[model samples]
Target: MDIDLTAARVVLLGRPGCHLCDLARDVVQQVVAETGDSFAEAVVDEDPVLLERYAEQIPVTFVDGRQHDYWRVDPVRLRRALAR
Candidate 1:
């Protein structure tokens, strides 16, 4: 399925085999579930632009199409952002 990341309320940028990405996914999933928000995951390695812009920031999280956090996701902060 083709997911429009821009339209998603939350976007997760990361590559496979990333431990941090795994953790971030879990937190994002939990927060979005509670907030009734939706999210999309984009593998940085799959897109050159995403890789270039966020290669060093795997596990990056974007809320409302704006960069929100990286390396780690704080559920409280994410919930707060979604509430905005």
Candidate 2:
């Protein structure tokens, strides 16, 4: 698939209608904006691989390809992660 690698400096996986996911995204966005980081938002249900791996863990955060947090995105920790 054609993709924008730079768009995913921070990856957030979630599904629509998930409150925790919504909350996490908001938290992530705040941290990203503060740190001037690029980000990718993925609806887990849209990708079989991600859906299978993260179906039960809707709001997952990844920093530079490594899992960072889940369920709830921590703004302080996210800021720290992005600063790295």
Candidate 3:
């Protein structure tokens, strides 16, 4: 699948079989459901640049193409960011 990162307001960088990524995905889905924003997932291991930059931060969250959070997704903070 082709993910248009530029069009997505939220981008999730993760790899397969990642526990943290799974948790983050749940949080992201909940937040976006409430906020009516769209999100996309990119496999860090699939892209060299993403893998290099986020290998240690598999569950990274990006809002508007800028880094938002890593390891975990804070619902309150995410709601605040989306309101911006």
Candidate 4:
């Protein structure tokens, strides 16, 4: 509840009733526990533009405002991105 609000900027693009999206959210929560970094969630379905752009890729992840991961999260790749 009192974690650092700076360290990394992450945005998760997901939709309701998507299991993969749920998984991605869990992954981000776990990473936050380990990294003490701030994390935010964005439901792509809320925005027409984002929904249109990522309709196929439900669990899209963006780090520092740039696309970093998608569909499935590669733990090694995620760690590397955070280390940057």
- Best candidate, TM-score: 3
List per-prediction Cα lDDT, in the order shown: 0.87, 0.80, 0.88, 0.74
lDDT of 3 by residue, 13-41 (tens): 88889999999999999999999999999
lDDT of 2 by residue, 1-84 (tens): 122223588988887899998899888888878888888987777777777777887788888888888888878888888887
> Which of the two, 1 or 3, has more lDDT?
3
Query: Between candidates 2 and 3, which one is better according to TM-score?
Result: 3
Candidate 4 C-alpha lDDT tens digits along 1-84: 122213248777787889998998888877766767667877776777777877898798887777888897766677678778
Question: What TM-scores do the predictions have?
Answer: 0.90, 0.87, 0.92, 0.84
lDDT of 1: 0.87
Clashing pairs in 1: none
Worst 10 residues of 2 by lDDT: 1-10
Best by lDDT: 3
Model 3 pairs whose backbones collide: none
Model 2: CA > 4 A from native: 1-6
The 10 consecutive residues of candidate 1 with the worst lDDT sum are 1-10
